[model samples]
Target chain A: MDKTINQKAWFLVLPVFAVVAFSAILPLMTVVNYSMQDTFGNNQFFWNGVGWFKELLDPSTDLGGRFLASLGRNLLFSAIILAIEVPLGIVVALSMPREGWTVAVCLVILALPLLIPWNVVGTIWQIFGRPDIGLLGYTLNTLGIDYNYVSNEFDAWATVIVMDVWHWTSLVALLCYAGLKSIPDAYYQAAQIDGASRWAVFKAIQLPKMNRVLLIAVLLRFMDSFMIYTEPFVVTGGGPGNSTTFVSIELVKIALGQFDLGKAAALSLVYNLIILIVCWVFYTVMTNAGVERPAKKGGA
Target chain B: MARIDLVDLAHSYGGNAAPPESFALKPVTMTWRQGGAYALLGPSGCGKTTLLNLISGIVTPSRGKILFDGADITPLSTQKRNIAQVFQFPVIYDTMTVGQNLAFPLKNRGVPKAEVDARVKQIADLLDLTPYLGRKATRLTADAKQKISLGRGLVRSDVAAVLFDEPLTVIDPELKWQLRSKLKALHRELDLTMIYVTHDQTEALTFADTVVVMHDGRVVQSGTPAELFDKPAHTFVGYFIGSPGMNIVPAAVSGHEARVDGHTIGLHRNYGVLPAGTKIEIGVRPEFLHVAAPASGLLSAMIERIDDLGRARFARVRVGDEKFSARMPPGFSVPDNMVGLVFDPAHVHVYADSRLVEGVA
Candidate 1:
């Protein structure tokens, strides 16, 4: 038998690389160019070596304060979202039926929220959370809860978190649901025969079986929440003060709101690097935890 | 260990009693003895799996009492019933090591650390899975994962029964044979009440002490494999239990004889008082039918095709409008134009209205 390597397979990947480089690399190079130099009016440039990077890191400066605050907020937001969504998703998934037209209906309902655009989700929450006119705010206020997202930082943060949960918990639910549905009924039978309690079944069979997808859900929610801009921007405008301003919001404020393009470029670069670093850590830890250990040769 | 009894169990999915219905399983009443190995054998959608599920308490019976050791447990949840089930496909935790998978039941029961380890080792040794115990179950082969499933079921000795629902369907054919033998040995060694369900007759016949032949949700007959093969209570069982299956020819019965297409086969015993114009079928296994000289037999047949299996030759023959299979010794030559079938009259079964005639056996 003669086996030859087919170099023609490279043709299939060339188009993909071409598109990625054209769309991704060109803008990235522009950002890198801006990050390295100081630009004045009309595109006049001067080299300011590491000055913006140093300023963004210094705690005494306003830029550093906003940067660190937003980073803290982003981390906190991701933690809260994960704490709420993952368990809720698993519960919803387990409650679903295993077969029939009901599964189809539930799947369609679960997927409807994911199909909506992210910006549209922001707009929906914006209208849906108004104190006087919005249904949620009106209901809460009528019930005498004093819900005001505009003036209250806590209310603004809570509303954003809740809105984000409503919009994106479906993604985690769908993923975990796929994991749960893939589990053969045999596992349930085994758990039953073991005389496992409901908690034990969930802890031993369901949770361990769903670990891979849960890790994926955690990573996705972390990245999305850390970089979340549109929904919070539209809903709270990062306000009552800077309480709800995440990293992406602060970056947008530096670039478009303040027009300090050079510093904004540097901050954006640092922001991208931080996300990259965190994502790397997340990927490494998750992949390690999720790694299927190779079978040992001989042990019981 | 407890004997499981299913009393007057009937299931209708739609709650309707119309004929030619769509119910997945019909009414059934049977008992599995304590520490006995029984198999429910049928083709797909034949309700064998449903019966197994009902026995395991996974599904509540619509109309029956499931008694474990003479206590009604029909309404009980599967957990309370203490029945372990190995599925057709592997169901071990992919994230857990094989040792952890085997030890899950023990851990759930809050067994002591030493006892859990001891039981895991015992099951691992029984299943020949000791070498793979520390390996992640997900990284193992399909057969290995299935072995883990089996080991998990066998690890716990306190269960009332361990049920296998076509547990070898996903295994390789050669490996299926090996596993079937291992299961038989396990059943004997452990003395656990085992109910195995499979559509394959070979597995059922080889592994089970009593084979429950099911079709369309009803247990048509429950007996030893030999009894099912030799005296199939229903025509479906007659056709399902053998490789070439039993040959059933529609006939008209008169006195101690059955006449098929103007040819009569005499019987040693009389079917007393059969209806004047009753529709009947003569059933005979292929193994019992012999191809001899045309003049010496009851009926003549035309040889259609000869299947050369290594140990035996199956001659597919046509007798009038009906077709029948006759098994012969390997290398037996078939005559060119005609073949005559000679079956012992004592071995023939007469079925009326799809049920065995009373006292025929």
Candidate 2:
């Protein structure tokens, strides 16, 4: 067979390459350059060769201690939020109205929080948690509770977690709802014919069908909660003795507040790498879960 | 197995107060005896599915009661009805193995594990699904998944009746015959009451002992395939059943003859007089109506086309403004456009207002 390869196709891709270079590659290259070198203001620089990464990973040095502490906090926050959100999202999806006008109303209400800007969400919760004036705080205090997000570490964490859940749980619920909706009515009817209890139906039919969407919900909720910044920063300012100081806040403190560009750049690279690896793992596991062969034998 | 009966059962998606014209299933009263193989056959939107769902309890009839072997089960839930229904599309649990899928219904009913295993094995073997028992059901072919659905329905030995709602729609054409024969064998071996629903007449006629014909939301006729073929009770049945179907043309019926386009065709039975002011027509299957050389006595027709269907030949003929299909006798070539139609008096049925009219013998 005579085959001719087209060389002109390369030119067709040049526009996309140019766009990506300016939008992503160029900024990322600059970060990589900064991460590899030490700078002493006024554009002065020197190569340090993985020194910042080593320190950031270590727990003894000041940068290392702060980075590790905030990383731990970020991991914990991601864990807590995912544990709460995934099941809560599925429950919300299951309880959603199946038909009629109420379905549209419920969908719009579910989407309300997602439409709010990130900073707006942060600001709303910031004021909402003020013990003296905010509804939540005032109500809690009136119920004989010592709830002050501004002063208590536990309260700060609680307020941030609740705020994040309020802001993002809707995304998970909507995805799960979409998955649930895609299930045909035949499945429910079949389950009914099989004499399956409600729980059996959920376990055997609903959960398996929702698997793909729940994976997405977990991945999004995990990444979002891990890199949480504005909400906690606005609500507690990562205060109450660095209780809710997630890694993004720490990175910002190093890069912009302290103007330690090298450290911030190194932290940024590590953070990006972590997210990429975690996302890769999630995608691999989830997509595999969809078509995996747990039993590969005895079939022709 | 239990005998099922639908007593004055009806359903209207628009609610009970809706007009009669809006009912998805017009009031139907029938009995499906135990261990009987029945097929509800009709075109799309003919309420065969509505009837099947009503029996399965997936749909609650808008009015009237359903009984299982004389016990009223109208108010019972689907689970309480102990009926199994396979849907139009395969509805297997994706997470389960083929064996697990087959075992699901039994497990749900808290049947003994050993019995569940044995029953699942029997059903799986019956379906030729033994090799895939440990394989995930979702990984199988469309037909295999459908087999799993069927197996799930059959694994429960004591179901009131196994309902199939066009279960073979997704199966490959080649596999359809294989699966259909397998179902016939299972029906015999299990002695379970199976109600198959489909729009295809061949599937209904071959798979069912009694094919129930539905039209415009009403059960038009329910009889053996031979009965439906030999004597169609309604005009729709006459038109819907046979391959070429029954030929129906408007005519004026009086005494022992039906006049078609000013030509008289003799009838075996004497319909002394049909109701006055009512439209009259005659229905004859192409099998009985033969095409012959043009003659003065026989009803004259203009032959438009002749279709050789391999096994038999048929001529499409026009009598005045009406068209018909008539059997072409063996080796009887068409002689120009003019032809004579010979209608067997024994098979000729007169219709009044699109319904069969009984004549005095």
Candidate 3:
């Protein structure tokens, strides 16, 4: 068969390329340019190739020290929140009403947190956790536990973690619920007929059915938590000696707070690269999990 | 293996206070012999799956008792029933390998590891799944997955019975034949009491020693395939069992004779008295009724069309206001629109109110 080569296809792709250049590529290129150069006041610029990157990576340098500290805190925050949310989400999803008007009511309650704006969630928790006038802080203080998010590092961390959990766990629960709902009734019946216990059914049937959605939930949660800035900034303002300042917050402090655009741009590039790498790994794992191996030779 | 019996078993999804018309399964009192292969044959919504679920203890009957080997098991949970059931779609553990999927039932009941392995191996071999034992079950084709479902059902030797609810519905048409025959061979080799539920007549007839035909929510007829074909006990069975189904047309049946469209047709037996005000109908299978030249037979018919079905030819004919299907001879061509239908008197059956009426010889 003779195949026709259609060069017109390239012309059709020009508009899409133009859109990407304007929306994504141009801004990213500007950041890349700033990352590699130095600029002083009044739009003064000078070539300083790799200088900002070098300072950003070396721990002895001020920029590197802040970047590494915030990166570590971000990683720890992500780990803790994931540890608390995933299983809790699964439990909530499992307990969701299977039918009736109650299902709608439960779903609405679960979604209440996610529907709230991120800054608004931070503001609510900020007032709600105040020792002077807030319900949670006043109750905790009355119970004889020392609690003050404003001045205590431990309290700030605890308040921020709890706030993130309250705001985001519903997303994970909703995803897992969709996965659970896709499972056919036959699996549960078959499991019962097989004399399987409740735990066995969860392990064998429910868990396997929810694998794909769980992976997506984990990936989304990880990325969102790693890049968290607005909520904690409003609640803690990276207080108690920079304890709650995540990588994104630290980058913003350098770029906007200190007016060190070159250093901030360098930090932004590295942070974006890390997210891209992790996302790539997750995508590869998900796609690989779905691929079937070719059948072995000499088999019926 | 155990003989499973249902004593007045019935179910209504609407609960105990619901009226009889709301019953999903009408009361059924029947005993399934040990090691016998029985097929519940019916169209959709005919209570086949409901009955299967009742036997498997998936759905509790609203009334009556179920016994396994003379022990009441109606109140028992599905886990306590000791019966295996395959659903319409294959229910397999996606994370498990084929070997593990087959071994799951045995493993759950705390069977010895070595025995579990042996039983899994045996079932895999029987289903020609030996080659895929190490492969993940989720990666297999639909038919292979269905085989895995069947394997899980058959893994335990002491199960009272195995119930299949249209297990081959997801299989490809060509593969359906192979899988069906495989199930038949497994039934014979294992000597297990198997109750297969299907709407397809071919699957039921070819796989079962006895076929129980159901209609509405009731078992209308239960007999061997040959008996169901030769003497259908109910009009539903007569209409449901055949290829073109039996040619059923309204008629006036009297002693040794039936009148259709003011023409008399002979009957082999005497239906002395039919119930008053009941709709009387005579049924004869297409195989027993042949198309003949005009005025050559007892009743005249107008030939509407001739359908050549590769294996045989059947003529769609109309007599008065009723339509019928009759077999056409290989060399016979329509001489005219008007023709005669020759019915074998022995194959003629009389039905009153859709219930077959046995006649005296």
Each prediction's TM-score versus the true structure: 0.88, 0.97, 0.94
Q: Cα deviation of B126 in candidate 2 (Å)?
A: 0.9
Candidate 2: tens digits of C-alpha lDDT, residues B248-308: 9889888999988998889999999888988899999999999899888988889888889
- CA RMSD of all predictions: 3.7, 1.8, 2.7
Give per-residue lDDT, candidate 3, residue B235. 88
Candidate 1 per-residue lDDT over residues B1-361, each given as its tens digit:
8888888886655654644356677876778899999998999999888788888877776676889899988888876777888888888765678998898877877889888889899899989998878878777889998999999888888878899999998899999999999999999989899999998899999999999988887789999998998889999999998888899989887668888778889876788667756567889899988777578545888889887777788889898889999876555675575877787787788888778885442
Which docking band does candidate 2 fall into?
Answer: medium
lDDT of 3 by residue, B168-267 (tens): 9999999999999999999989999999999999999999999999999999999999999999988899989999999888999999999999889999
Task: Note the B-chain TM-score for every model.
Answer: 0.94, 0.98, 0.98
Per-candidate local distance difference test: 0.84, 0.91, 0.92
| lDDT per residue (tens digit) for residues A106-197 in model 1 | 98998888898888888888888888899988899999999999999999989999988898888898999988887777678767876778
Residue B281 C-alpha lDDT in model 1 = 84
- After superposition, the stretches of candidate 3 with alpha carbons farther than 4 Å from their true spots are A1-15, A289-300, B293-297
Candidate 3 backbone collisions, by pair: none
The better candidate by lDDT, 1 or 3, is: 3
Candidate order by DockQ, decreasing, is: 2, 1, 3
TM-score between candidate 2 and the true structure = 0.97
lDDT of 3: 0.92
